[model samples]
Target: MTRSPVLELRGLSRRYGQTTVLNDIDVTIPEGSFTALLGASGCGKSTTLRIMAGLDRPSEGEVLLSGKDVSQKTTHQRNIAMVFQSYALYPHLTVFQNMALPLTMRHLSSLGRMPFVGAVAPGSSKARNLIAEKVGAAAEVLGLTDLLHRKPSSLSGGQKQRVALGRAMVRDPVLFLLDEPLSNLDARLRVKMRAELVALHRRTGRPFVYVTHDQSEAMAMADQIVVMIGGKVAQAGAPRDLYDRPASRDVATFIGHNAINLFQPADGMPGLHPAADEAVIGLRPEHLSPAATGALEANLETAEYLGSEIILALRSERGTEIRAIAPGDYAIPAPGSPVRLGFEPTRLHLFDEQTGKRLEVAS
Candidate 1:
């Protein structure tokens, strides 16, 4: 039996004056799973994350956590820990101080929170010890044990990021919200953090909702990915499922390693009968190869050699640019020289040009 979602957005929406940023968006995140919301800028990915974080309110629909409605609750009321892209750490505070913020604030009253006044406040000692223990535990997990005395100004980008995560971790929330948490890092750091973040998620066994525009990053980090477009979920599924069986042309192009070769029916080939509703054909570069008796003839515009494979760029008679990938040793005609590209009919995908949606071909 399927378990209830740990986080669910039911017909969620957001609007600005005459424009609708999101339209009836619905998504569910399972417990102990990593879910990434991916899309280009202005596609409502950030807005969706804001709404889920309770930093922004939805114009309509419900935000449910573990099957209960939380649309009306504030961030403080919900058992969620959110880490922003900016890290949001205090420049003057040490790692230990920052990680203990949530717990300290929760247990101490306003007057008891003052530097000197809090020392003698009733129950302050007990709370301080508790906060210290929590902070120490979190710092250990984040490998910040030795740097607990260091402030944000002295920490590296990745260290500061881990500090921010440590602060969230001290809260021990069931749900984790990360908004492009690694986008500010360098390419090498981003790659390193991807593996670390995934390992952290697995170790903690908590539900995580991540937001990112980079499809490759999302595919690498998320157990389930939600592709957003115009404020809606264009597609959602496992990384491999989305890559191998994209439901629409937009998704096919968005989630792959390279641009998918799209062909219209007007540029027909023998033995392939596109259905009446099929207006476009989508083929990945790997599925296409140079053949002696290939159906389509095109010029080799360029050859890109990557260690194990070579990507060939071709321009057909109808002026369509197509990309095909084959073994590095495959012979390629010089630029402007004619060549034939071939593929199995079953490997081609049919889509509707007007709707940009995939069309089902009878098996």
Candidate 2:
């Protein structure tokens, strides 16, 4: 069954004076799915997220939430929860207080929010109890029950991030917007939090729009990845779809862990296909390796052992540098030794040299 879209950006574009930040952006975020908005810094991903949260407005286009146009709605009026990269927790408030702040602001009257008066004000006690229940539930889910009394100043980076997520979770929002929420954590902690976030997404059953610059993070966490380039959406689809068949040369280079080796016509063709004479060819390092009787030969320059694999850097006879992966157990050859490299022809990616667009080459 095709789930309905929870949010849609129709022809969305953001501008600052004479400068354009986002250009003709159109994206659909399906309900109960994780979608990642991925791009390098200053590519307008954050601006797109801000516009979706109603923190910023688009100069051109509409922001739709579940079929309703919310282009002009304020952040509070949109009923969307946003977790920033900074964690955004108040240092003066305990974890419980931080998590409960959103509910209190939404459910309590001005008189009911007064510290001492809130306890005795008419109808305030009931709202306070409800808030407590919700906050307690959120804290339990995030494993912060024991740290509920601690302020943001005393918590570790990961704990603070969870508190931010807890605050968002308690809102019961229609959608969740996270702007690089795990960027501040150490590498090890970031990996741990990624699993926690996936579990949280399942528990909440709400659409998540995550913004990130890290391709690995996007590939690991999102069902759909929108790769933005030059302020426009270059591609949007499943991570494997983008990885296996990129829409353009830029996407092929950006989506993979190891940079793709791009061979131009000027850089002597490997003679893999007739189409190669006029098009650029791309091959990933992992797909190319040293073979005893390989078609191409290069002089090994450097070999890096990374536990499970060895990265072999070599220069082909045509003066083109290439990187290939070898088994960790593979014997290392001396520098300047000739190495034969082989690759599966089916793995070759052809692109138009002029437009940098992908070219379809029949097997």
The number of the candidate with the highest TM-score is 2
Stretch of 10 with least lDDT, candidate 1: 269-278
Per-model CA lDDT versus the true structure: 0.87, 0.93
The digit string of per-residue lDDT tens for model 2 on 302-343 reads 999999999999998889999999989999989999998888
Clashing pairs in 1: none
Minimum summed lDDT over a 10-residue window in model 2 is located at: 268-277
Model 1 over residues 1-363: C-alpha lDDT tens digits? 175588899999899888999999999999888999999989999899889888899999999988889888887679688998999998888888888888887878887799899899998988888889888898998899999998899999999999989988898887899999999999999999999899989888898999999999999889899999888899999999888878899899898888898777666543344462347878898988888887778889999989799999988777878899878888767799998777887777778878988887665
| TM-score quality measure for candidate 2 | 0.97
Model 1 global lDDT (CA atoms, 0 to 1): 0.87
Q: Please report the candidate that would top lDDT against the real structure.
A: 2
Give the poorly placed runs of model 2, Cα more than 4 Å off. none
